[model samples]
Target: MSSEETLKRLALETLEQDADRIVQLIRVQMDNLTMPQCPVYEEVLDTQMFGLSKEIHFAVRLGLIDREHGRSILADLEKQVSDVHEAYYEHREQLKKANK
Candidate 1:
């Protein structure tokens, strides 16, 4: 395949993998936090947030996603990540609850 096509495929795969990992991590954190005493929960939460930010930064550096395009396409995804994190303290919340 052409380089553009390869890059596009790589970009899509990277985003998909990141999204899945983030959601899974969020779910685990939410599940663990259902109990009253989880000391490491906050740390795990912070790590996931940092991971998402890092993924965005990587995408920017690789030029796979332009800022303007990301603003339009990924804005909602980023917001969902933030919102899911905010709702992490809630027992019934799921990362899947965020926009897909």
Candidate 2:
């Protein structure tokens, strides 16, 4: 394909990989029983997500990716993160119920 198309594809792949890293991080924290409300945890997540958003914005402005595609990437990551939180909470609740 054309050089422009190659660059755009690379940009999208990089963003998706970064998003996967964030998801893996959250999963690791949940596996280790790190409290979601912990200040450090919150800060790390906020910082990482903010950085990703900036990167996506840069790619969009560079014409390496479209605005809607960038948004979709972020939205998918957010939904995955939310699902992780929900699963963690549900598991915790089950543990509590089992103990009683």
Candidate 3:
């Protein structure tokens, strides 16, 4: 496979792994009844997304992926993250209803 192909594959694999991690995080927060405004929860989200984005840029600088490809990769991951957030908010609402 070409370097481009290799890079793409790696990016996908990494993204899948990270997405799973994010899901696990969301699950744990829900289990603990944590809110989005929780500082620790916010920190984790910021750290995870920021770290992944920086990694993508580093890969671009190394020529493993082009700028556009990097953006696409990050976009896919961001969408997954967004989905997790939606689930979290839904879970939070359910918790609120249960409490009331």
Candidate 4:
């Protein structure tokens, strides 16, 4: 493939990897029973997401990735994060009932 194609492929891979890392971080927090409402948790998620969006914008501006694809990546990440949050709450509710 051409160098430009290679660069685009690398950019997409990097963005996906970054998104996966964020998901992993959320899983770890859930596993550790960390409170999702904690300010630190909010800050971390906000910062990581903002950084990823900037990277996506930069790639799109450089013609390294399609605009729609970048938007889809962010949307998918948001869905995954939401799923994790919901799972955490469900787990907490289960624990409460079990303890009673």
Kindly provide the TM-score of model 3 when superposed on the true structure, using C-alpha atoms.
0.68
Against the reference, the lDDT scores of all candidates come to 0.63, 0.97, 0.75, 0.97
**What value of lDDT does candidate 4 attain over all alpha carbons?**
0.97
For candidate 2, write residues 1-100 as lDDT tens digits. 9999999899999999999999999999999999999999999999999999999999999999989999999999999999999999999999999999
Model 4 misplaced regions, further than 4 Å: none
Q: For each candidate, C-alpha RMSD in Å?
A: 7.5, 0.7, 2.8, 0.7
How much RMSD separates candidate 1 from the native structure? 7.5
Report clash pairs, candidate 3: none
At residue 58, give the lDDT of candidate 2.
Answer: 100
TM-score per model over all chains: 0.56, 0.97, 0.68, 0.97
Per-residue CA lDDT of model 4 for 32-76, tens digit only, reads: 999889999999999999999999999999999999999999999
Candidate 1 TM-score, true structure as reference: 0.56
Is 1 or 2 the stronger prediction by TM-score?
Answer: 2
Better of 1 and 3 by lDDT: 3
Clashing pairs in 1: none
Q: How displaced is residue 4 in candidate 4, in Å?
A: 0.8
Indicate the worst ten consecutive residues by lDDT in candidate 3.
Answer: 11-20
